[model samples]
Target chain A: MTVTRSKAASIRAARRDRWAQRLVQCGLHAGLMAWGALAVYPLVWVLLTSLKYTRELYADPFGLPKHWKWSNYQEAWVYAKMGTYFLNSVLLTVGSLILVLFLASTAAFALARFEFRLKGLVWGYILFGFLIPHSILLVPLAIFTRQIGLYNRLGGLALVYAAVGIPWNVFFLRAFMETIPKELEEAAIMDGAGMWSVFWRVILPLSQPALATMATFHILSAWSEYILALVLTGTTVSRTLPVGISLLEGHFTSNEPGVAAGMAITIVPVVLAFAFLQRYVIKGITAGALKG
Target chain B: MRRGRKRGTSWYGSPVGIFLFVFPAVGVYTALMLYPSLLSLYYSVLEWEGGPISAAPFVGLANFRQMLSDPIVPLALLNNGRRLFLDWAFMLPVALTLAFVLSRLRRGASVYRFLFYIPVILPATTMALLWRFILSGNDYGVLNSLLRMVGRGEWVRPWLSGDGYVQWSTSFPASWQHVGFYMVIFLAALVGIPEEYYEAASIDGASGWQQLLHVTLPNIRGVYVSCMILTLQGALGAFIYPLLMTKGGPMHLSETLISYSLYLLWQKKTWGYGSAVATLSFLLGIIAVALVWRFGRQRESALYR
Candidate 1:
């Protein structure tokens, strides 16, 4: 009789544990759903508002529009001259990005592959640059650029971008290149490849993933930079999309729809690009951070 | 150091080869970067308002004295304090909690991680614009509308405008936007913890909560310290968001140290005084870096040495 009673007690405890587990699981799902809604709500509101006319947007701010205004997108696009800004942005961003990658890669390769006197000293100097806030350089760089007659010029800004990017980029690429097998380089050299040839053919191709990672980061930074653009360029055509988008705030007083449309116009292409390239971007950023 | 590679051709030893290897980097650093940094220090002591260098008058410590007396300096510092507090309050815990939850999920974790990371990849301009609309005072704002439907009508207010609820209003959206990014970083740290440690703790009859306290916290302490340092530095130099959303006001309430300094130099053309603020910012940055280095060393000694 005592043995049977103990068996019943064990069964009851097991059931209680099962129920507790179920309760916890249910709570977890509810919490995640709430968090996800919080995340998605803002973007959804922007999208829906962008599709609504100004009249409907104000009249029923929270309601779905009876008629969607597809032309709003086109209007925002043309008003901002975002098309021209987009082209300019692409040119400048790509130019700066290429310069950053080439300089950073070569520097990183030298630091990683060669051993020399004061190598540690050079590494320390490069690393220290990362700690200096970029904002501190703004005023100084502006004056310097103006004095040199390079102010308001894209080529000038590209040089500045390369300067800022090279430090962190070299640090990151150096760490990555450090992991590449020395045997691969040795094998290439034995087959009569010179240092330049080995670097161009073997090492460069091998480091494509790191290069892509750096390029994507540079693109993201350069494409969205506003302060530098605001300070450097004066002309509307020369100004990039970020500054152009800021001006959208001035258009249409208390016009929520217009602002939303403007936001959507700038957002969609970038969001779509992010959506596609996000995996690589995440890997790259995380890898860079971890390597640090 | 490999034995077989010792006698290989010394391409780097040639004079032209050495120049090819090193000159480009050194040339860019010296002319474009280092020279300007030094020149800024020189310009700081001068009375010139961004004029040609030759026309400037020397005014030693006058700019520094003005910075000390400026009311905008304190106001901006106070604003930075608020930003730093709010960032620590919201971004830190929310990120840790998200990492914890995301780590436990069995399926679709990568998709969710990618979803959260999208904002991180967006240009800061787009991200700022995205939030500017989302937090606008309109009843159509997703946040305000949700509050209304939930019958919290009294809670809705102009987020980026007006003196009412100024502090909480601006910070919430800013924190919410960046939480995903910090969460991803924390998640990376979390994932690096080996699973066998957790299993061993469980086998030893430690409960999940206890194990987390004992094992997980200790393991991630280094990450926590480093991230905190990064976030603090980012907060100290906070700009773009407040500049875009409020232009640092209903009454200059949101203007940060960096933003105020930028205004001084660019808007008012008080270039000399602005350089003083920049100098202060640089000093603060150095202090932050020193603290991080010290903390890293202490933690390394505790954990590994």
Candidate 2:
């Protein structure tokens, strides 16, 4: 009788433990979902608010719009000049991506493959970029550019972006290139392929993953860059989206829905790019944190 | 560079080739980043209004004197300090714990990561604008609306426009987006711990909490140090939030050092004093980083011992 009683008690205890385990699991998942809501709700509210008439915006902050006011987007794009800002940002992103990849990748390839005097000096020089606070650098850069007649031009801004990225991009790609075996480059040399051919044919093709990572990263930074654009670009002729969208604040407080639409416009491309390039971006962040 | 032309040497390995490869990058970097930064050192000690044509008379520490006497300089510095403390107190612990738990998950981790990381991708401008709307003074403001619905109308105040609330209100959005950023960093660090460590701990009859204390936290010390540096830089370089949200006002209450320097540079055209302020702010950044490094290295040795 004692043996039977002990077995029954053990079974009950085991059941209770399982119940507690299940409860803990449920709580964990619930907490995760709640945080997820916190992350997503503001973005959703902005989207919903953009579709409302300005009157309905204050009347119902959380509810769905009575009418999906597509005109908010139309007016923001046409009247609010987000279209112009959007184009400028696109031009800047593409232009800088090309310049950055070429400059960073070549410098990285040479630094990785060649032994030369001043290599350490070169590395230290570029690394010094990180030491200067960005705000301090801006005033001087603005003065330099203005003297040269490039101050307010998108082309000049693109050059600045390319240069700003050189420090980290070169560091990252050089590290990546070092991992790529030296044997491949020697084989290409044996085939009588000259330096440019080897770099173009072997190194560049091999470094595609790192290049893609930097290209996306550059795009993100250039697209979102503000203070530089604010200090440098004096007019709508060259203003990027972030700076342009912000300029609306002083003049268009009544056009809150229009600004919401403008915000939506600014974000859509980022969301789209992020969706497609999510894997590379995640890899970029990990590498950036670990290696940088 | 002529070293490349030696017999049996690879063309790319030649000195000329190396110079060619590195030149454009180095030149552009020097022109844009390094040269400008060096020029700030010169300008900080000069009396000049910013155009090329303006005479830059050497001021020799006069701007620094003014910086010492300025009231807003300390206020701006304190604002950055408050931000750093708030982030460490709230964001870092939450991010670290979330990353730790998510690292242990066998399923649905990707979904949560995706959800959490979406905010990190948004621009500072978008975040500022979104939060401004959410925290607006009027009926459209989400927080105030909620308070009214709960019969606590007395609690509602103009978040950005009110007398004392501007600083915290601007800080809220800047801090909000960073949770995902630090989480991703910590998550990467956490995911990198070898399964063997956990197995060994379990073999020794260690519980999960014990393993976390003894094994997990020690492993991510390097990443945490990196996070600290990034956090400090983020705090000091905070410009967009106060600029867009509050315009550093009702009366310059929310000004960061950077925004205040921008005002001195543009609106007031005190270029010399502004350069001085900017230079000092950067010096503070370097000193702050050095302190973090000093403590980080000290703790690292203690951990090993």
DockQ of each: 0.38, 0.54
Candidate 2, residues B32-105, lDDT tens digits: the string is: 99999888888899887755525778879999898788899888887787788778888888899889878877
Clash pairs (backbone) in predicted model 1: none
Q: How does residue B203 of candidate 1 score in lDDT? A: 93
State the displacement of the C-alpha of residue B88, model 2, in Å, after optimal TM-score superposition.
0.9
Q: Tell me how candidate 2 scores on lDDT.
A: 0.84
lDDT of each: 0.73, 0.84
How many residue pairs clash in model 2?
2
Instruction: Give a tens-digit lDDT track for model 1, residues A1-292.
Output: 9999999999999999989877876777678767777676666777888888887875676678789887776766677576667777777888898888888777777778877666787777766667666777777777778888878878887878788777888887888888899999888777766556666677788888888878877877787778878787777667777877787767656666766777666566666766766666767757744643
Tens-place lDDT per residue, model 1, B1-305, is: 12223333566334455456556765666566666666666667877676665777889988878878887788778777777787788788888888888877755567667666655545566566666655677655656776787999898878877664555555555666777788777777788889999999999999989988987878877777777777778777778787777777777776778887787788778777777777677677679768887987687787776
TM-score of each: 0.90, 0.94
- Could you say which candidate leads in DockQ? 2
Cα shift from native, residue B224, model 1 (Å): 0.9
How high is the lDDT of residue A18 in model 2? 90
Please give the TM-score of chain B in predicted model 2: 0.92
